[model samples]
Target: MSRGDAHAAVRRRVCLSAAVAWLALEALPARSATTQDATWPEEPDPAPGRGTPADQAPIDWPEIGLLDGRRRAPQSWAGAPVLVVFWATWCPYCLRHNQRVERLFREVDPARLQVLGVAVDRDERRVRDHLRQQGLTFPNTVDDGGLRARFTERRVLPMTCLVNAQGRVSLRIPGEMSADDVRALAARALAG
Candidate 1:
């Protein structure tokens, strides 16, 4: 073969090898740069100035402040699985995801799980009204942005993570997932 043709073949082989390597990297399970514990007291410390509300839930646990002047911490649900979703009112994916989540919430056994919705949007009124118009009965809170940023990876919307009963983050998902998918994820989270 001509030298030019040989060089072209070499380049093609190199490109193919690089593409394969990239795909292999992508297929691996994603672990956070900051490792999350799989199971109490081992949970990451609360981000400073989290702006959790004063009238927190009566449950004795870590207080994750809410929008309605209340807070529900992971500890509050002590021994029960906790699902926390970091969402925004304007995110279209979040709107659809919430609908699926509503169904999951209804079908799931509350004694085995707890869900926390954190709205990172600044306008509490808009967030509250939007959720109401959508008939979302699950409790949600408006974060001052700190808590959301802390847990968010890629700063994406509809990030969902599950803290197992032991206060460890069993799953940290960042993107929209179907109701069935979330249920499957939750099943694993709660089984802890």
Candidate 2:
């Protein structure tokens, strides 16, 4: 081959290698970050009429059906810090966010921090398949219409809310979150 041709070939190979590396990295799960690795700011007091539904005194969360063919009554979680996530199966952001949540669920003591995923999709089978494919065992329930109304449907996927032991909503995040952010939220729940 000509010298020019050889150089061009080498450039092409380098570009291909970089592309492959990037894709592989993208497919890997995000590294779990401890709460100590990042700082979490306190949430500001909500303005009048601007509060989320869970912001109500002891959110009258209705009974929810679990994926495991069981029901979770609101009172069952009355005195525990519960992390409720509203997500859909097809949302890309939810895919990444749920992975971090799965990690947090596995790492923390269930008694200290209860995690619940509310799948907001219409197809129950799709939600189940997604959870099974992702190897996520955290308690997830397909959201019936009631949950959407009760949670006040923020029109955003992967909405994560932290409910303190007192049943007060402490924080509500409306989008994707980093590993440190998730950890810090759980840390705050544990501390509270």
TM-scores for all predictions: 0.63, 0.73
Instruction: Please give, for residues 1-192, the per-residue lDDT of candidate 1 as tens digits.
Output: 999999999999999999999999999998643222323123332445432222222223346666566766445677787788888989988998888788878877877888778888888899989988988877788877666554533476788867667655555566787666776776776667
Q: Which one wins on lDDT? A: 2
Which sections of candidate 2 miss by over 4 Å?
A: 1-55
Candidate 1, after superposition: displacement of residue 45 in Å?
16
The 10-residue segment of model 2 with minimum total lDDT is: 33-42
Clashes found in each candidate (C-alpha, N, C closer than 3 A): 5, 0
TM-score of 2: 0.73
lDDT of 2 by residue, 1-192 (tens): 999999999999999999999999999976643122334343433444545434476667888888878898878888889998899988988898999999999999988899999998888888889999998889999877677555454567778888889887777677788887898889888998
